[model samples]
Target chain A: MDLIRKTNTSYLIFLAFLMPIMIGADYFLIQYLFNSEVEETLLHEEERIQYHLAKDGDLPISNYLHEVTPIDKGFELNPKFKDTLFFEAYTDKNIPYRLYSFSSSIDQKPVKITLRHMLPEIEELIWFFFIATFAILLLLVIGLYLIHQEIYRSTWHPFFKNLSMLKQYDFSKMESTQLNSSGIREFEEINQVIITLMEQVRKDFQNLKEFNENISHEIQTPLAIIRNKVVHLLESKNLNKNELRQVESIYQETNKLSKIGKALTLISRIENQEFKRLDRVDVSTLVENILNNMEEIINFKNLDISTELQPMTIECDHILADILFTNLINNAIQHNKEGGWIKIRLSTDTFEITNCGDVSEVKPDKLFDRFQKGSSSKDSLGLGLAINQKICEIYEFTLNYESKEEIHTFSLRFKA
Target chain B: MKVLVIEDNLELLQDIKSFLEEEGNICEIAPTYKSAMGKIGFFPYDILVVDITLPDGNGLDIIREVKKENIDIGIIIISAKNSVGDKIHGLEIGADDYLTKPFYLAELNARIKALYRRKAYQGSREIYFNEIKIKPDSYEIFINDKPMNLTKKEFDIIHFFVVNKHRLLTKEAIAEHLWGDHIEMADSYKFIYTHLANLRKKIGELGGKNYIQSIYSVGYKFTDQEWT
Candidate 1:
C-alpha cells in the first residue's frame, strides 16, 4: 500500500511540473506572434508616410511623425509604461503618419504608417490575443487536473484499494478477497506479489496447526498409561496371589508411558524439521521387516495370509516408512475378526495390505484423523493412520484405504 | 482369570503385577513389542492389558494382530491419550474396554472383571463371590441361597463394593460416582458415610460380616477380611 501511494504521488508531481511549463511555453509563443504582427503594421505605416512626404511637400505631417517617434522612444525608455499607443495623421494624399509608442523614452524613431486608420482595430486584436493566452493557460491547468484524476481512478486507486484488502487477509478465515482489475503493469506485479505472500502465510499456518495437534496426541498416550497404572495400584485390594499380576500390569503401563514420550519427541522432531536423512530404501525389505515383526500376532490369531509380489525398490526415509507400515498393518490385523484373512501385496514401487476387519464405524474421509478408528476394536491410539498419512505426505507417496464387506485395505503407491 | 500385561515401564508394570497377583490372578509381562507378540501368540489369557505406546512398536498394532488371529482373548486398551477419538478408535477395533492413563489400577481390575463377565456370562447376569451372589441387572443380593432385603442405597453401595472388591476406592470418587454430575456442588460428603454405615449394619443384621474397610484420610476398601 505504501508503494502504491508513493508511485501515485510521484506521478502527480510529474504532471504538476509538466503542465505549467507546457502552458507557459504556448503562452509565450502566442504573445511573440502578436507582438511581431503589431510591429509589421507599424513599419508599413511608416513607409507610406515617407512616400507621402516625398510626393507632396508635407513637412508638417512628417515633423509630427518625427515628434511621435520620441514619445514612442519614451514609452520604451519608461519601464513602468507597459502598453503601446499609436496615433495616425492623414496627409492630403491620404497617406498617414503613425506614432507607435511602447511607453519607451526613445521618441526620435517613431514609425509612420500608411494604413493608419486600422491602428485601433489592430490594437484590439493584440489585447484579445493576450486575454485568449491567459484563458488557454487556465483551461490547460484544469484539463491536466481532470486527466490526472482519471489516471488515478483507472490505475492507482484500484491497485491501492486491492492492496488494502491484503491488510485484512487472515488464514483462520480462509477467505480471500478478489483483486481489483489491474490496468497497468506495475499494479499487476504488485498484486501477484501480495497474492503469493498470502498463500505462503496460509500454508504455514496450516502446517502449524497440524504440528500442534500431532504433538498433543503423541503426549497423551504416555500420560494415560501412567494414570491408569496408578489408579489400578491404589484401588485394588485383592491379596489372593494376584499381587504379581498387578505388578506386571503397572510395569507394562509404565513402559507404555515412556514409549509415548519417545513417540511425542519423535513427532516433534519431524514437525520441527530435525531429521532429513534419506537413502535408497528397499521397499521389499522394509515391508518384509514389518511383516516379520508382526509374525507373532499373525500366528496367534490364526489368520490366513495371502500375498502377491513383484520386486520393487524406492528411495525414501526408511525409518519413518517402516513405522508407517507397521502402524497400518498392525491396525488392520488387530481390528479383524477371528479367523480373518490378511492379504499383503508388493510391486516394484507400490505396496498394499488388506485384512478382514469391521470398518463400519469409521468414516472414510476421517480415517486418517488422529485417534479416529472404526468399531471392531478398542485400545488403539488411532495414530497409525495419522502417522501413515504424514509419512505419505512427506515422501510424496499416495496412501489410501478402502473398506468393503469387512475387508479393510490399505495401499501405499510410491511416486515414480 | 488370566491376564497378560504388555507394557514397557518397569515401575508401573511392577505395581500392576503386584496388585493383580494379590487378587489371585496370574499376569504375564511382555515389555516390548517383540515379547508382547510372542506372549499373545503362545499364551492363552482371559484378558490382555495392552498400552498403545510400546517400545518395539505401538500397542495398538499388537491389539490389531491378536484380533486378526481370532483369539477370543478379552482386550483392555490402556492408553495415556484422553482424546475422545482415541477412546472411540480403541473400542471400535474390538477392544472390550479402553482406559486412559492416570486411571486407578482398581478400575482396570474392575474393567477386566467386567470383560470376563461379559465374555463368559453373555448377559445371563450374575456376579458370584463365595456364598454371596448378586444379580446385577435386578440389583438383588442372595446370601446362602436366601434373598436379603436391602435398601436402594445400601444395595447400590454393596453392589459397587462387590464389583470393585479387593480395591481401595477413594471417597471423593465414590461420592462423585454415586451422585453423578451433581457431585461438583456437593457441600459435604457426610451422606456417603451415612449410606455406608447403613449398608454395613444391614449386612451385619443379616449375619454377614463387614467387607468394607476404611483407609485413613483416603477412602474405603472392600475385601473379604478373613480371606485376606
Candidate 2:
C-alpha cells in the first residue's frame, strides 16, 4: 500500500476503538457523582426537620418527603441514611428515594421521623448522556479524519509529481531532472540527490559513447595502414606460395578487425540514439532487394527461395530497416544447408522466414547476443542477429525465433 | 592521370603514392592539411585522394577548399569513419566517391582508375586489356569485336580485374568488391571460384586467352602473360 493510504487506514482503526472507550469512561464518572450529590440533599432535609422540631416545638405533617411512624416506649431504632421506596398519592407511583431516619421524641410522644429525597432517574440520564457522547465523538472522528486527509494530500503532492518525473526521465534527450522545491525538507533533499545522481548517470553514459567512437577510429586507422601494406606485400615478386598464403591470412584478419570495429561502433551508435532520421520505408521492397542481392550466395548452397509479399510499410530509420532485413535474410541463407528450401511470407502486419539448416545447439535466449553463433565458423562475425534485435527493439516490433530439429524460423510482427 | 594524395599518415601516403605511381599515374603526396592546401593552390591535378582525419584539419575541409578552385578535379574521400551521415555529407559536398579505410590497395587502385575515367572530358569510356574490351558504363565486354554475354557480377569481376591488372587480388578483396562492404560473404570463397571459372570459360570460348591465374590457392593474379 502507498504511504497515505496506509497511514489513513491505521488512524481510522485507532479512532474506532477510542470512540467507545472514551464514552464508557465518561458514563461511569457521571453516575457516581450523581449518586453522591443525592445522598447529601437527603441529609440536608433531615437537618431542617430537626431544626423545626427544636425551634418551633411543632412537627410537620407526614408526606412522601417525611414519613412518621409511632413507636413503643424505649424503642431501639437505627438512625442513619438508607435507600427506600415511597408511594405518592397524587402520582400513584413508587419512586426511589435517598432517606435519612431517626427515632426522636416529637411533641413529647415517642415517634420515628424519616426524611426522603427523590433520586434522579439514572437510566434516563444515562440514555441522554449516551446519545450526546455518541454525537460528539462522531463529529470529532469525522472532523479529524477529513483534516488528516487534507494534510496528507497536500504534503505528498510534490513527492508524487517528482516521482513520476524520475520514472519518465530520458537520457537521450539530455533533459535535466531538476526537481522543484516542495517546501518539505526531506522531499526536497531527496529530489536534489536524484537530480545529482541522474546528472552523473548522463555524464557517464555520454563518456562511454564517446569512448566507443574514439576507440573505433583509433583502431581503424592502423588497420587500414596494415591492410595497405599487406596488399603491397602480396604483390612482391620475392614471395613464394607459403609466404603469399600467410600474407593473405594476415590481410583477411585485418579486414575482419576493421569490420568488427565498425560493427561495434554501429551498436554503440544505436544505443546512443544517434540515428534520428525517420522515413517511411517499404518492407516488401527492402526484403526483395536483400534477397535479390543474396541470390548468388543462395545458389552456392543450392537453396530454394520462395517469397510472398504484400505491400507493407513502416516509419523508421530506413538504414536500420535495410540492415535488419539484410541481417535476417543473410542469416537464413548463411546457416542454410545444401538442397535446403527457404520460405518467406510477408504481410502488412507480420513477416516470417523459415529455412532448414544444421541443427543449432545455441541456446534460444543466447541467440541474439553479439558473437553468439549457432555454428563455429571463422568467417562469420556472428553479429547479425544482435543488430536485428536492436533494431526491432527500437521500433517496438516483436521478433520471435523458434527452431525445431533442423528447421529454424524467425517472425517479426510490427506494431500497429 | 595526375593525382594528388592528401593524408596525414606518412606511411599510408607513401603506400598509396607508390601503388598509383606504379600504375603509370603521376602521383604527388601531401602529409598535412597545410601542405595539401599549399600544393593544390599552385598545381592542378586530375584527382585528389583525401583522408577525412588529418593532423591539422579534417580532410573534408580540403575537399571543400579544392572544390572552391573549380579545377574539374575528381575527389575521393577516404575516412576511417564508416558512418552513413559522413558518407552522405561527403557526397553532398562534391566528393566523387567515398571509400572507408582498411581497404585493399587494389580496390583503391580500381576506384581511382574508375574515377579518372569518369572525370576525363574526352576519352574512351571503354578499358582495353590485350583485346579484352570492357565498357564499364553498360557492363558489357567485347573480344575480337564480338559482344560477350556476362552476368552483372561477372561483368563486375572482369571490370575489377581489368582495372587492377597484373596485381594480386585476394579472395577477400574480390568478395568485398563484388558484394559491397556490408554483406557477410566470408563463406563466399566458393561463390568466387564458381563465378571466376564461368567467367574464364566464357572468355576462353570467345577465343580470348585465360589471363587470370590462381596464386597458391589464396588469391588470383591477372597478367598479360598467357596461361600454359
Candidate 3:
C-alpha cells in the first residue's frame, strides 16, 4: 500500500475497464462509415441502371454487382438497403453482401432492380482497426504511466527521507529535530511543523528533567536531617527499648527513602545523559573488582561462586560501567538462597550471571521496570534492574533475564 | 583538632558540630557561604567540612579560597549530588574527600578522622581503642600489642566502629559505609552481622574486652561498657 503502487493500480484498472468500451465504439464508428460509403455507390449504380433503361426502353446487361430486371408490380418502389449472404458456386461458402433493392418503371412498365456489394473484408477491417487503436491508446496510457511513476518517485523522495529522519529522532540524544526542507511546498510545511513541535517538546522536556533532578537533590537534605535527628534520638540513653526501636525504624526508613531518591536521581541522570566521560573500560576488571568487594557478602550467603572471564574492553562511561556491573552482581548475590551457587561467564561478545534464587513468576522484560522485582523481597528497592536496563540501552547492549526453576540468569550481549 | 563546618542548614550544622565536639574535636560553625568565607583563613582549622550547595554561594569556591590561602587544611565536600563527575571535580580541586548527603554522621566522622590523621600524622597514622591499635594506612590491626589475624571486611567494621566510638551505628550505616553503592537498596544487615560477629570473636580471643555493644535489633554501639 505504498503511494506509487496504489496510484498505479488504479491507473491500470481504469485502462483495463476502458479497453472494451473503446473497442465497441471503434466497431460501430467504422461500420457506420463503411455502410454510408457503400450506400452511396449502390445509389449511384441504381441511377445508372434507370438511365440506361429509360434511354433505350430495354433491360440493361446483368452483372453480379448490378442487375436490371423486370418484375410485375402494382405500386412504385422506394430504394432500401439490406444485408444478405449469397452462395458462390466456386467458393462453396456464403459470402456476405450489402444489397440495395428498388422498383422502377422501364418502358412505362414496373421493373425491380437489385444492386449488391460483397463485404468480405469487414471482419478484417474491424480487427485491423481494433489492433491499431488499441496499440496506440495503450502506448499513450503506458507512456503517461511511466512518466508519472518517475515524477512521483522523485517528488516524494524527500517525504520518505523525512520519515526516516523522524524514526531516528530521540529527545534525550539531541536538542533539536531540525529537518531539511524539500523543494516542494507541502513537504516543506511538514518539516517546518515537525521542527517547531520538536523545539517546544525539547523545552518542556528540559524543564521537567531539571525539575525532577532538583527535587531529587533538594529532598536529600531533609532526609539527611531526619536521619541525623533519628540518630541523635537513638543515642539518647534515657530512651526505653520501644523508643529505641521506633527511632531505629525511623533511621532505617530514612535511609531507604534516601536510597530511593538517589536511585531515581541516577536514573534521571542516565536519561539526561549527564555522564559523558567515555573511556575504554575493562569489563573483566570491573567485574573482578566488584566480586572482590562483595566477597564477604557472597561468603556469608554460603554461595558457591565461579567465574569464566575473557578479557573484555568496551567503550563506556567509567562510573556507569561500574554501577551496571555492581548492580547486576548485587542482584545475583541478594536474591540467592542460602548455600546457593552463582555461575558467571564473560566474553567479548556476551556476559552472563546465573544464580540459584527463588523461582521467579515475573517475566524477564517486566523485571527491568522500576519497582518491579522478581520476587517479593520487601526490602529490595526494585530499581536496580531498571537502572541496569537504562545503562544497557545507552550503550546499545542487549540485557536479558531468564529463570528456569530456581536458577535466575541475567545475560548481556555487547553489540558487535 | 579544630574543625570548621560550613553548612547553610542550621539544624544539620548544629547536629554535626555537637557530635564532633563530643568526639573531643573543637568544632566551629558557619551558617552561610558568606560566613564561611569570612572565617576561611582567619584560623588554620585542621579540617573544613563544607556543604557544596549553600544559600549564598558554592562551597567549591571556598575550597578554592582555602587552596589560594596556601594553608595546610583538609577539605571534605558534602553534597546531595552523587555524580562521579562532581565527586571527581571536588577531589581534583584539592578536596581530600567527597561525601554524599543523607549520609550517616558516623561515616562522616570516620572520614573526618581519617583525613585529620593523614593530615596531622604525615606517615604514621594509627588509632588506638583501649588495647586495640589500628594502622589504617596499611590495613593492619593489633590487639594487646600483638597483630590480630583479621580479614579486610572485619578490619573495616572494627575500624568504622572505633572511629565513631560511643555513637550508635546502625547496621544500614555500616553496610553503606563498607560496601557503599554496591549494597544499594538490599537489606545488608546479614553482611554486617556476619562480619561483626567475626570481628568481635577475633578481638575477644586476643584478650581485648568486648567494647562493641549490640543494641538490641536496632544497631551497635562501641564504648568501654560491660554487657548489661
Instruction: Name the candidate that leads on TM-score.
Output: 3
Give the poorly placed runs of model 2, Cα more than 4 Å off: A16-149, A237-249, A358-362, A392-409, A413-415, B121-124, B143-149, B201-210, B224-228
Q: Candidate 3, overall lDDT?
A: 0.85
Ranking by lDDT: 3, 2, 1
Candidate whose DockQ is highest: 3
Better of 2 and 3 by TM-score: 3
Over B1-228, each residue of candidate 3 has an lDDT whose tens digit, in order, gives 999999988889988999899999999999888888888757779999998888899998999888987889999999888877878888998999999888888999999999988889984878988899999978899999889887787888889999998888988888888888534645478678767777778888989888888877768999996534
Which sections of candidate 3 miss by over 4 Å? A40-64, A75-78, A86-95, A120-130, A182-200, B182-187, B226-228
Superposition error at B162 for model 1 (Å):
2.7
Q: Report per-candidate TM-score of chain A alone.
A: 0.46, 0.77, 0.87
lDDT of each: 0.64, 0.83, 0.85
Query: What's model 2's TM-score?
Result: 0.83
Evaluation by lDDT, superior candidate among 2 and 3: 3
Error in Å for residue A35 of model 3:
3.5
- Model 2 chain A scores worst on lDDT over the 10 consecutive residues at A57-66
Q: For candidate 1, lDDT tens digit of each residue in A93-173?
A: 332223353222112344322222222344454566556665765576567667776777765787778867877665654
Give every collision pair in model 2.
none
Error of 1 at A310 (Å): 61
Using all chains and alpha carbons, the TM-scores for the candidates as numbered come to: 0.48, 0.83, 0.92
